[model samples]
Target: MPKKALIAWGGWPGHTPEQSAKVVRSLLERNGFDVTLGEGTVMFADPKLASFDLIVPVITMSTIEKAELQNLVLAVRQGSGLGGFHGTMCDSFRSETDYQFMTGGQWVAHPGDIIDYTVAVTRPDDPITSGVSDFAYRSEQYYMHVDPGNEVLATTTFTDAHFPGIGGVVMPVVWKRRYGAGKVFYSALGHNADEFAVPEMALIVERGLVWAAR
Candidate 1:
């Protein structure tokens, strides 16, 4: 049987969750995954959440209930993969430290909002970033609070164009981690659906989904 994947999207429309969810669903489908698209935070409460091979949470900066958050954590710990990009994963569930712990990062700010920046692949041997070269990207150069334990695959440096006290700082752009038996993959890309068209950006996300699956 093909691997099953669940993509739950909603929360702030500013991130274009719905469109990005569709893009992710299509990519997984093309990769032969049996994909399910879910809406809102309620799906996190589903007892069957752990049954899937992977779960992609695309809700940005939304509040999840205690029970819902607990269930999601349990599911990941029990061995369901979690993968996402930009604010979809790292930026979601702001107040839930447990969620942050599981994913290994949280979005703090985008210094220059949308600007051109370089994404340097730090780990060329990693499956998610292999064969992909460093490239220029236009979007939010996310200044995040990331877990040092994360196996960082890509990074970007911050300049003093828009924010002070953060110049010349290097930030993780792509990382893969483990939460118990589950594999977690995250990329600080794709602020909107249009970014999915970027060859390098989309390739990383596609590879991440496959690499993240249980």
Candidate 2:
């Protein structure tokens, strides 16, 4: 049977959640997944959430009810894979520490807001990044507080121009971790749907999603 995927999107409009969802849904479908699209967090409250092989959240800076959040958490913990990009995953529930803990990071700020930067493939041998070379792009360079246990696949260096304190600091651009038996993947690259048009960025995210699926 084909793997099932659920994509729930809705939050800050500036991030173009709907457009991003459509882009991701297409990718998933093309990859042989049975995709379901949802409009809000209420979809997360589904008791059958764990039935899907993968869950993708395109929401940004939005709130989820306690029950809905808990259900999503339980689904992942019980072996439902969770994967997403940018603020949708890391910046979704700011007040929920458990959600952040499971995701392996949280977006704190973008130092320069749509600045040019290079993404270095730190783990080129890894399946998710193999054969993909380092590439440069113009987008929000996310500065995130990440979990030490995460296996970082790609990273970027921050300069002193924007945040002096983080000068020369390396930040994880893509990573994957395990929550219970579930695989969790994330990338701090997609600022909008159009950003995925960058070949390298799109490939990395597509590979990450497949790797994260249950």
Candidate 3:
């Protein structure tokens, strides 16, 4: 049987949550997953949430309930793989430290929002980043509060282009971390459906999704 996958989208729609969810649904299905979709944080509280092999949150700046967060975090801790991109995962629950702890980062700001930047693959040998060359990208340059334990695969350096005096600050663009027995992966790429068109962005997120699933 194919592995089970759940994708839930909600909160701010500016990120095009529905479209993002659909893109991921297609990708997961193509990778032989039994995909399920949910809207809002309601699904996060589902008692059976941990049954899936992977969970993807296409959410942004949404408030999550205590029960919902507890269940979701517990799911990952008990081995439900979690994967997502941009603000979808990391920026979802602003008030939940546990969620941030599990996801490995929180979106603090996107300096120079949607401008040209370079994504440098730090771990070229990692499966999720292998064969993906450093590429020019036009999207949010995420400045985040990231986990020190994360295994960073790709990064981008900030310049004083938009925010002055912050030059030479390298930030993790893609990373994977362990939350209990679960595999957690995130890419600071894919701000919208259009970004998935970029080969480098698409490749990193696609491979990262597959790599995160149990």
Candidate 4:
């Protein structure tokens, strides 16, 4: 049977969650996944959430009800893979520590807004980043508080031009981790669907999604 994937997208229109969802859905479908698309955190209330092979959240800065949040958490903890990019995964549910802990990071700032930056493939030997080289692009360079346990696949160095305190700090751009038996993947790239148009950026996220799926 083909892998099942669910994409729930909504919240902060500035991030273009819907357009991002379309990009992700197309990739998932092309990769032989049975994809389902929905809106908002309400989908998390589904009791069968754990049955899907993968769950992708394209939402940004939205509140999730405690019950819905708990359901999503239980699904991942019990082996449903969770994967996402940009503010959707990292910036969602800011008040929920458990969600942040599971996703492996939370966005804190994008100092220069849309700025030119380079993404370095830190784990070129890893399947999710293999054969991928460092690439430069103009977008929100997310400064996030990431989990120490994450297996970082990509990173970017912050320059003093924006935040002096964080200058010289290398931030994780892409990473994957294990939540119970589930695989969790995330990328700080992709503020918009256009960002994913970058061949390297698109490939990394596509491969990461497949790798994260159970």
Estimate TM-scores for all models: 0.98, 0.99, 0.98, 0.99
Off by over 4 Å in 4: none
Task: Give the range of the ten consecutive residues with the poorest summed lDDT in model 3.
Answer: 199-208
lDDT string for model 2 (1-214, tens) is 9999999999999899999999999999999999999999999999999999999999999999999999999999999999999998899999999999999999999988989999999999999999999999899999999999999999999999987888999999999999998999999999999998999999989999999999
Worst 10 residues of 1 by lDDT: 158-167
- True-structure RMSD for candidate 1: 0.7
Error of 4 at 58 (Å): 0.4
Question: Candidate 1 at 177: error in angstroms?
Answer: 0.4
lDDT of 3 by residue, 1-214 (tens): 9999999999888899999999999999999999999899998889999999999999998898899989998999999999999998889989889889999999999987889999999999999999989999998899999999999999999998899988999999999999999999999998898898998898888889999998
Candidates' lDDT values, in order? Answer: 0.94, 0.95, 0.93, 0.95
Residue range with the least summed lDDT across 10 consecutive positions in model 4: 159-168
- Scored against the true structure, residue 202 in model 2 reaches a CA lDDT of 91
Superposed by TM-score, candidate 1 places the C-alpha of residue 16 at a distance from the truth, in angstroms, of 0.8
Off by over 4 Å in 3: none
**Candidate 4 lDDT by residue in tens digits, 1-214:** 9999999999999999999999999999999999999999999999999999999999999999999999999999999999999999999999999999999999999999999999999999999999998999799999999999999999999999987888899999999999998999999999998888799989999999999999
